[model samples]
Target: MESSTQLVILAGLVIGLIYGAVGLLSGFCLMSSMRGWLAQGDGRLVRTYALAMAVAIAASQLLAGSGMADLGKSIYLQQSFSVPVLFLGGLLFGYGMVLSNGCGSRALVLLGRGNLRSFVVVIVLAIAAQMTLKGLIAPARIALVQASQITVNANSLPSLLAAFGAAEATSRALATSAIVVALILFAFAHPSFRRSPGQVAAGVIVGLLVTGGWFVTGFLGADEFNPVPVTSLTFVAPIADSLQYAMLSTGLTPNFGVATVAGVFAGSLITALATRRFQLEGYSSPRHMLRSAGGAALMGVGGVMAFGCSIGQGLTGLSTLALGSFVAVAGILLGTAAGLRGSLRVQPLAVA
Candidate 1:
């Protein structure tokens, strides 16, 4: 590979390491946060999540505004996207996250702590994601997207504002300010969340990490001759790609995503070991195993269709202010709500 590619890969690994450690230490899972807020009547974790979103938006937009990274290059900024497909995908992924008790990133962190059940989740999720991305499910996914996708004049929030009347910089600033302010207000409104400094730091660090991923791929990896993909931290496709690379190293070349995926597992493992938190764990029963497997499959398929997982669309994608990301995120929140409240809520499973 090129020298720039190596640097990008190394950066990806570092970013993943930090992410894994922070996620494990802070219990940074969207499903868990939602469950805590809606079901358990605790909003601290969700507040942390909101802060992370606020930071990600502020930092990412700054990078883009400074011409350091082109957010336009990312998949989330596509001119044409399917509202139905993306929303449906988000709903599936969110509900699956509830069923599985976590998202892909959380599973990786838990697996690092010797959760054998997460191992199953990781493997099954990877396989299912791969199938959706390029295997048997790809054709159907592609057909659906092609059929339902709609073209829009403005792909991102800033662009939408620019189209109306504002200059590019003004539009970006306005949009970013609106979102960042709202998120910050939500995050800091609760005294309980404000008191949790560790959670606050995790949110800031994770947000910065998302920006770091963009810097690595969009700036550090930028080469006229051998250009690397302008992307950042997202686990769905990367987890699948990591699995494929592990099995087919002879033919595949490592990229930012795969390297990050490996680093997350390794970093979480090290943290768990150092903290004496590592302990082997598995499914409670066959029924539990089945539920987990089914959830994994749904996450894989849904994540692919939505073009990201929780961390993917919720944080990284939203950082770009993409319209589709908003749609997908809305779906994810609604889906999570469905699983957390009302008649559709998923009840706690009984131990076997």
Candidate 2:
């Protein structure tokens, strides 16, 4: 039998490679999607995002229906609802993404594209993630979660459907199909989006990546002896976890996120070098740096509280159709709107 670490490491590398290639190729950016719709009146990027969400939900539901995976095992989708936390977390994450000029996945992609400013965002996010995960803020987080915890299970649309008398497979399939079809219709309805093959392909591929993450962690990582943490993509904690692993690799074994994070930067660096996109760029001013720093920190804290960044909870976790994900996604939209809307004067600060 293969060692657990070996299996996990292999999965991580594979997932990482896929994500890196996809990130580099498609220029997938949730922050861009929200910003485009709000700032520029362009909905192509948002449509791409919606397409991915639909595909992810459909594919993940199929997996769940097949009894190949149980999405309820993931952390973000709790049985009992926490509306306040989810909304607040989403808002924080959305604002932070705007401040950083992109979400976690977008940041990684930008880093590959010779944007040094993204490097600062990633570093700050990672540090803040660590602080929230097990550092100074961990206790408070734990306390808050415990204080307002509610008990619910399988908090997904499929579950709700099943509760309403639909069979397991039927309910999952219906829920998945409805969401997927709606999203695809939305994407195709736009002429501009139809012409952007690069963006469309990226959306589909990234959707696959999200589901693949579930398969790697939830399925392959399932060990009767030493099970791995059941999770998918999310930038905030992974960065911090990556930092923590770099410092304590001997003590802490690698997980999918850690491996993926490493792969993103490494793969991006390699791709950038090959494509002549590599450069050392940084903030032109202290204010710029401050915005990046603040945005990253908010993403860390908000991602932790909300249970994911755009790709993490919005796509990967939400694919499960979990109730918490819906709440979180709503919050993210609200927060992004606040930052992207000029009427609110949410200007992007200069970098340090």
Candidate 3:
């Protein structure tokens, strides 16, 4: 209703559009990247992902450093968090991503390209996330958090550094520089990745979009009377919120998340149509459908518990250097590894 809110919503839509387009064009999914690197022995996509993380951290920290945004206000920087719960959630979301063949954002992009399989994934994931957030699963989730959550003086890497006697700005700069440099070096280490300019650009743009989301909420929407939630790009809860808003439009007002979700679908749809990439697709069989549905449900519940999905914890949350984000990301990587390799790997379906 307020002008600042409207601006934030508009910004969210624009950011989502860019993200959807970039994701579709560049194949920017962590699951796919991991599979490529670990299974197929390709590393370009993974490099792009690493670059995105680096850029996100650099840009986000710059914003925070300049006092343009308050990174501390975000949920990832909580003083008390349950390590076990977050790690478990990440593992579930990661394994589910492998089963579903993508994350929530990827499903949205694919759905826009007329993948009926992704449509199923999106719907089921949303339902599962909603249930976990507020339905029958909420009590259990809450209880677990209450039981395992621990309090700490330093909630993030930078904060921890500061607690160890480093100046606030010095801590932020040191942490950001170290992580960003390492990621960038890793991304550029491969000649193959260095050759793909489009992928490189996609990574940069996606990272900027994450920072843009923070700016929209933390700066543009920082109204004293109607303060918006200081947050950025994360898919799990947003996708669920989008679905709820769709069904209950009369009572609910659209937020940045809802607008971004809708924009992602619309952007991907338009791009697919223009590029002649839109095509109808469906599950191969009942067994395939069951697998997808199960994966979606797991992703829903897991994403909620972890406080983010691949893009959420992996990129946006990590940009803040939160200790819990590191734990969750580690869990996700391990879970993805389990699904992609070793005896526990989910094998390719045999075509009947």
Off by over 4 Å in 3: 350-352
Cα RMSD of all models vs. native, in order, equals 0.9, 2.0, 1.0
Instruction: Judge candidate 2 against the unseen true structure and give its global Cα lDDT, from 0 to 1.
Output: 0.81
The models' CA-based lDDT, in order, is 0.93, 0.81, 0.93
What does candidate 2's lDDT look like per residue over 1-352, in tens digits? 3586577767777777667767776666888887787788999888889888877887777776777666778886676656677778889999898888888877876787678888888888988877888899889888777777677655788778888888977887888888889889999899999999988887887788778877877787788787777777777788888878888988887777888887787677777788887777888888778888899899988888888888888898789888888889899888888888856546865443
Tell me the spans in candidate 2 whose CA falls farther than 4 Å from its real position.
1-4, 349-352
Question: Model 3, residue 94: displacement in angstroms?
Answer: 0.2
Candidate 3 residue-wise lDDT, 1-352, digit = tens: 9999999999999988888888888889999999999999999999999999999999999999999999889999999999999999999999999899999999999899999999999999999999999999999999999999999999999999999999999999999999999999999999999999999998999889899998999999999999999888999999999999989999999899888888888889888998999989887789888988998999999999999999999999998999999999998899889999999898776432
TM-score of each model, in listed order = 0.99, 0.94, 0.99
- Model 2 — which ten-residue stretch has the worst lDDT? 343-352
Q: Rank the candidates by lDDT, best first.
A: 1, 3, 2
